[model samples]
Target: MGLEEEIQELEDEIADTPYNKSTEAHIGRLKSKLAEKKEKLEQQQSGSGGGGGYGVEKHGDATVALVGFPSVGKSTLLNALTNAESETGSYEFTTLDVYPGMLKHKGANIQILDVPGLIEGAAGGRGGGKEVLSVVRTADLIVFMVSVFEIDQYDRLREELYKNKIRLDTEPPRVNIRKKAKDGLTVNSSVDLDLDEETVKSVLREHGYVNADVTIGEQVDLDRLIDGVMDNREYVPSIVAVNKADLIEPDYLPTVESELEERDIDPEEAIFISAEEEKGLDGLTERIWDELGLIRIYMDKPGRGVDYEEPLILREGDTVDDACRKLGGSFDERFRFARVTGPSAKHDEQQVGRDHELADEDVLRIVARK
Candidate 1:
């Protein structure tokens, strides 16, 4: 009958079916069909255009979204970390719109978004969840904020993002496909595959691939295979911040630490902060910088010394060519060579080319053509 009912039926069947070698192909086909149904339903829903999306324009070197349930101190955290005066309140849904702030850390301007708190049924488009989740999909990183009193909210937050097709902290599966004419579906893999070729073909056919050459580089389960076939997912890195640490009693610290461990997040690694008191903001900023994989490169401008006070920010593993491209204008077209002196260089002021990989705090001098 209806697409929603059809999707639920497919989901129920896949869940009810047993998993084994004999039933693997069946389950895979069911999963493919379910994914197709979900995709179609999502398209229909998007076309209906119910919610008013946020007017959040990505800015600065990178953007991070503050995601959590209501009254998790996201606004307080945003105010403490950046210049944005986000309204902080003790009640739920305090932030009705997306408030953007800029944090100047390590010579990088990082854009921080304090959006409305994500409720439990966000993936189902409840409470303007679709609009909020849409803003999050564009962020470079997601800072999962939860109160020390509500550490369990972390799982629900991640689950909402997952249902919205926002995959965190993982690379896209290396599944490549090339369409052909009249040769039929063929699957190839260097590693041993868990799914039989039939299952792969079923997924391809569900996505309307009749004759194609498919290559899967690694072993993937049904979900990963589906993700590979569907290219609309967003892969992002995330950091967990347990806010309002000052409210927790000393005796309950171990219990708090235990909860984080249960979530597979090291208590030491997770940033524990009292956002209202401005405590642990330093640690949070440091984690943001590290997780963003940013590095500072001091440019050696001619007729002037190296500018270390305002170093150019670049992502790690970036090369001299990348630096040139970032500089924009004539730097890219008139480039000749470059000299580097710092962590990335073999020696001080070593002559380097466009392919030279720059490290943090590297002093770079581009010898462009006159």
Candidate 2:
């Protein structure tokens, strides 16, 4: 009989099991056989054809790219993140070619691209600026690296991106300060200033709060700014890495944090890590993984003659039905049932229905009639 006919017969047998004790063991045996068939079907499907082992094309996995001005430690961070031997140096444009590496976290592998350092006027075809930013645009996430020691570094980088029309959500607003903090007036204490609403709006606009309405003494929402940066790309998330933390003085950390806050970026999302020292690398990796919403699940079938060592990485919302659909329409129609063998399984081996949700490291054994 065909796979479909076999599944139908098993279903009928299961329905009649309670009615007849003579076929109870037979029904159980059918269930086991069906599970084995499904496992083989899925294994064949997974190995069909794909660039990255998941039977999908390139860019199927979430991609994160490192971007920043020259000599900003982008290459160093890439090396630290992936343990890949990417060239790093204090000289500008040390990395002329884009290097791709996979960083595995919690079974999910994230493809990270390290692009060449960008300079001012990069978008205008100057200093290979536009070409570099174009590459950055394709990235799902952009890690903007900056050196704290450089005077007005943030402003300079923003100006370069603006001149090139390289869109960055965190550009600060421009304002002429006619009123300074009064002598002996501390920042903690409030002082009256002759500033109009338009002036305040213009200032806020330069600080990356374009089209924002504001009032004097009113607090600005930083979370909204972070959301704006995230909205720069569709469905892709971004994270900030505050590199050279070891070089900067401890007292300067708060000021840097406040500046980022003013630009609408959260201090928490901006990780402070020394790529050279490998300090806080774990935290950075975890943050990136969390933001990407990726996970890995493995199917272990010892006697199934399939590779169980490598796990499948999937998005957070992926389901068993979704996976089957990815295989092909026929597989979905022929899907009889599924069984899982892993730490999360209810029993040593349990039958799973069509609507079953898969967890990380789940060793699934699917049963198909054929």
Output the number of the TM-score-best candidate: 1
- Misplaced by over 4 Å in model 1 are 50-53
Please, what are the lDDT tens digits per residue for candidate 1 over residues 1-65?
99989988988998898899888878888888888888888778777875555788888999999
Q: How close is candidate 2 to the true structure, as a TM-score?
A: 0.57
Of candidate 1, the 10-residue stretch with the lowest lDDT total is 117-126
- TM-scores for all candidates? 0.97, 0.57
Candidate 1 Cα deviation (angstroms), residue 96: 1.2
Which parts of model 2 have CA positions greater than 4 angstroms off? Answer: 1-60, 127-130, 150-235, 302-309, 325-334, 340-357, 361-363
RMSD of 1: 1.4
Tell me model 1's lDDT, rounded to 2 decimals: 0.89
Tens-digit lDDT string for candidate 2 (256-351):
888877766688777888888888889988877777666566654436643446666666767777657755547687888878766546985678
